[model samples]
Target: DHQGKGTTEPGVMHQEPYGSLLPFGLHKGYALATMCEILGGALSGGRTTHDETLVSCHDAIFNCMTTIIVNPEAFDAPAMQQEAEAFLSWVKRSPQSGDAPIQIPGEWEENNRLEREREGIPLDTNSWEKICQAALQAGMPEEELAAFRALAQ
Candidate 1:
């Protein structure tokens, strides 16, 4: 488990979980997660998750990031753009396994963004009510909340 809820669905791996999640690819995934913890915590001089590092401690969280930056100019491939386009075209040409259309990398998010941009996001009544309640509980002025609610409607 990588401390997340188990699901076969894509695009939901980053969600906060209600329970532990199974690591992808089983042991190999577990190994990758272990390395991430090491690099993001110990190697980066940040604290790893523990009793003292709980999010509830101070209502703020600390994050450590490790990244690799590379310059495209450093590479010798003169036709990199065309090569990448060719590979992506080849992959997209393959038959999909299910009814859902094939999406490459950020395509799903981009599609959703465009749809939301055109249609606006749909929120169920229950969720909207809960958000209002939370704002009130957080000491929002009733008159201000009412103004915002009017705009939302």
Candidate 2:
């Protein structure tokens, strides 16, 4: 089972999972995510846990694999590479707000993940307090959490 959790700052597309679709076109994204559900559920006879209430709310998950079958030799490899590079260059050259630089798909997200790993996840004070309280309620020793807080400092 692949289980992971991530956080993203507000207004950043990479942090917003469904937000990327706006740039790529929402209809296209809907089609793509829908295709994932169909193939995972219908083709493989696997029920997409995203659709079931208990599974959706709790520990169940679904997986889908999408592949593009491309024959590089059918087209000029160098030409294709050049075209891709050109497109990326154009995107990078777009205007930016203040010190922010234009980034292509996955770039901003990778950078954010790396930065957060180094600096620690950014959570508001209230959320942090809530988490600590929850841990205490869950029977986590107060001394253990206090030690962790000391180390975190």
RMSD per candidate (Å) reads 7.8, 11.0
User: lDDT of candidate 1?
Assistant: 0.75
Residue 4 alpha-carbon offset, candidate 1, angstroms: 22
Per-residue CA lDDT of model 2 for 1-153, tens digit only, reads 022233253343323132322413645776776777677665776665453633354433455454457887897576887898899999889878888788888899999999999998888878888988999999999999998778656
By summed lDDT, the worst window of 10 consecutive residues in model 2 runs over 14-23
Instruction: Identify the runs in model 2 with alpha carbons over 4 angstroms from their true place.
Output: 1-78, 95-97
lDDT of 1 by residue, 19-101 (tens): 34466776678887778777887788886655565545432245887766878789999999899889988988889788887
- Candidate 1 weakest lDDT stretch, 10 residues: 11-20
Error in Å for residue 104 of model 1: 0.8
Estimate TM-scores for all models.
0.53, 0.49
Candidate 1 global Cα RMSD: 7.8
Score each candidate by Cα lDDT.
0.75, 0.66
